[model samples]
Target: MIPTNRQITPETPLDSLTLDELDQLLSEKLVTLQVDLLKTYEQQLREHEETLDHLHRHRRAISLPPRPTIGQDDWHSYVYDTRPSREIASVTDLVTINFTNVHTVVDIFPVALDNIHAIYKLDSGNGYILQDDTMHLLTVRNQWTKSPTGCSCPGQASDTRCACCALGSVLCQVSASGVSNTCVEDSQINSHTCSSQSPRSLELDNAIAFEYHTYSEGVQQVVVIAKGENIHFYRLDKWGLQDFHSLKGHNTINLDSPVTHLGYGEMFVEQFGTVTRKRYLFTFGLDSSSKRYYEIVTNPQDFSIETGLSMMWDTTGTSMKVWQNGGRVIIGVQDGTNLNIHELTSDRWGRQQISLQQVLSLPAGVTSWRSYATGFENFLIATTLPLPALYLTVATIDRFLQTQRNIPRNKLQLVGVTAMFIASKYEEMYCPEIGDFAYITDKAYSKAEIRKMEVTMLNELGFNVSYPLPFHFLRRNSKAGSVDASQHTLAKYLMELCLPEYSMCHYKSSIIAASALCLSLKLLDGNNWSDTLTYYSRYTEEQLLPVMCKMASVVVKSSSAKQQAVRQKYKASKLMKISEIPQLKSKLINTLAEKSASYA
Candidate 1:
């Protein structure tokens, strides 16, 4: 069987071999190839069998309870409106009368006066009373009218036509002819609905501007009203308005400006070997061009305002929120077109000092106001929708990778999927089982592996998974702008496109929604941004242009082969086939590019 080849050495060429030797060499190579191919096939089959086994085990492990029906609990009752039957027309008519001529409601408060449940409606300059159960509007005195035509004095039969009249007044009658008492039933007032009922007006002596703040601890409720240079506090009981307290500003403290914002916070004090709850009030004032912050302790019998940190800051305070039970204060300040966060430390003493935490620059095409609102709106929506939860999960994973640069690229999808699992559990009523998630991935990961990865992700994220998504803001902004359904869907499509781009996280949810809405409107050739939209969205065309361009770029990119989830989702007929709108996509990209370059 061994060929000698005429005493051939190792230097003998294969081409110089005899015909029988060549046939033997080819046959041996063919046998080796067949063996290798069989082994590869066997390995792949084993892997497939393992995947199937894992899926079967996962299915066996999952056990979901039966879905509860409506009226099972408070949440179900709210969603299903499981209250006692009432006249729908009467309720609608009552609401119309109560809200008439009220340009903005601002705030509403409910209190039990004696045995009657009453609600207070605070309008810009006027106040109205409502019987909570019967939905009846109660009349009060000193109500003025400020119509677009002119202002009318009390008891005036004809239009006064005074330009200097105060804007605050009671809710106007629904009838356009004139003011009348027919809005409220005469019998209800004559019968004295409640024994302790009394007329209450929010008006303060010489008050040019006012704001309302409320806080509750256990059964005790307190309402604080800031008017001009004074802050008035009221304690409420089951019978309403128990005690009234006022804190007057002195020349030294100089609270001469209107109170722009009011907030209440609670802190835990650990001193003398015991922990106690301490409540505090935070007030922000704008004195002409200067902005000031005041902290006042509202506990310990003797209340005092801490003016140590009253010095003015250069930037104007646009919005402020207290989180972590008042331990952390997030202040949004305007620096040109950008909004920056000023985080302040808190202690038993008061607010220590302000430190600049983050500066959120208004990304080219959006205003600071809209951007700030978007972040909050996204948070609200994430609490309800699974899609938004998934978006947030993926975004968080991307954020972690940017910070931890050593993470392997292959594990990104695993981390993202685990995040989605966590978000779904936190946000959804019925979270998808682990087996279901595995199925979605075509069994790429087993249930056991995914469960392990969930623990890892939770640890990495510090168990914090709740965050806002752009969908919430888009829905809210679109509704407020009265945008059509088709246009709204298009805007949502645009927003989803931006979700995969990690860089888009720098912009706020409001800005993203506004930019998307603007682009959608342009593409649909619908009504342009109106004054109503501008007032509600707080964004101008100039501000949205840059953001729109960036969104357009994202849309174009999402249509490519690499990013297909969002594009495919929108390709369905139910979604209006937005992803397939080639003409609109092309137009948006080109227009945005030209506009963006011109602005630059």
Candidate 2:
């Protein structure tokens, strides 16, 4: 343990210092010493509170129960009454979902009579869930599929069969009435026909990709680009396929283009009015050179990209950042670790690029990010773990367990707990407490149980998160031999940053938080933040810039001042009442000894 000089005692020269001076002194110490920033700073308090010792006792009380298995079925049956009994389950407001976190929300929608699937919302109503082909429409009160086979009548029924066209495809569009959308499928396909194949089999040989949007005015539109590069924009209504407009830009998105990932910018209110954010469709895929681009689509007269920033690349992926003073077309990327920036500008044609730039570099690759809203003032959130690092950590854990045959299962639990604890401090803005996990475990754990599990997990895995971007940055800068240098440093910092709240499941938040911190350090001190960014993909200055500025001025300064005063008062006013601070500690030790002897 590092030695810290004690400024407050039973008696000292306290009368001379003003409140502000005392606060300033305390703030400096806390920043330098790194105390638990969020929690109350209590030096002398009650001890041996077994209830407090356990972290998760309260969790099970609040959270929903877990499920045994989540059946693989299209979600259509749940909301679709036309489907057979086997496809649906009774509705209940409380659902114990399988393989889903407690904080996540799942929505069921109708797609087709026979098939349906659910998707997690990434941004709006967002979370991550498996992909499906059917589109859920509450307006139509129906689920529709892209394949005609999905709509086959109950049992290959003849009357419901479409006789004109044998093509096994389906297309849906809204009518001019603007009330409901209609599904159009080949007339030859029967509702009851069943094939030996699974539903998700995509015919990549010929397929088109599209996007959907819902406006605040309740106007919904789906844009489909077809085989001949024809663009079809449909506004969903009661009749079908109304106000058809064909465009030429469909061909511009070539299959041969190097990029693969596709993203759409969300609509947000700007200083002028509601602005249509551009859609970002690009990729880290290697069939083409690593490239990135943004397609800005708004009323051409209203908004556009104005200028270019800067760009840089590392190992995991590439990233770009852009900003306009009161504009809402904010875009960020992290294929892995490469970073870029772009500005929204309205050119002469009212087309936006408007110009893009690459601004900073991070040590790790970035995967995803979330920016806090105006009031709360917190860090930019991002997740930055690559497959390889996870594998490495898993391997390390396996070997440790294999070698330490004498270690009990309880000890192994501690290792897992510690690894999660460390990861949380590295990633999330609001780290879950040890009590949170204990509560989730339904009071089936003890301090010994948690600590042992944490140690075992660490000994086995080394570090929970490991990735490549740091190596790329190091290699480019000639600091160390490879990315391993960054990994080694990350491993150390991750361990040092461990907090009481980390858990196995909430690792994503930790990954994001660490990435943000890494990026901040990169800008502030020019350290190996890119490596952190690579492992945690969500770190970007555009998202983090405001929060970092606030921390220096408000949070850090105020917290230090308050905590220092609390400690000083407690030491002088309270500490004198007792001979020593460790009196309760001894009592707890004695109690543990007696309990152990009784058990033996």
lDDT of each: 0.49, 0.32
Q: What are the per-residue Cα lDDT tens digits for candidate 2 across 241-314?
A: 12222231221333342332332332222212223333433222333333343343422221112212222222
Off by over 4 Å in 1: 1-385, 557-559, 582-588, 594-600
lDDT of 1: 0.49
lDDT of 1 by residue, 1-600 (tens): 445536445686987888877776677677676656645754665565456556745865687454343111111000001111111010011123434444444333323233333333343334334434333333221112112224453457366432122223232333355532211122333323321222344542111111223343333344455555665554443322322322322112336666544544444443332334444455655453325555443342322222334545444544443322123344544433234555555443433555776543321111112111211111100111245665676667765665567757776667666666777677665565565455334334666677898887677767766666677777778888888888998898788777767657778778888888888888886457777777777898778878888876666556464645566556655568877876555665776755555544
- lDDT (0-100) at residue 466 of candidate 1? 62
| Candidate that would win on lDDT | 1
Stretches of candidate 2 above 4 Å error? 1-218, 223-254, 257-260, 265-325, 335-340, 344-368, 371-380, 383-600
lDDT of model 2, residue 417: 40
Q: Summing lDDT over every window of 10 consecutive residues in candidate 2, give the lowest-scoring window.
A: 75-84
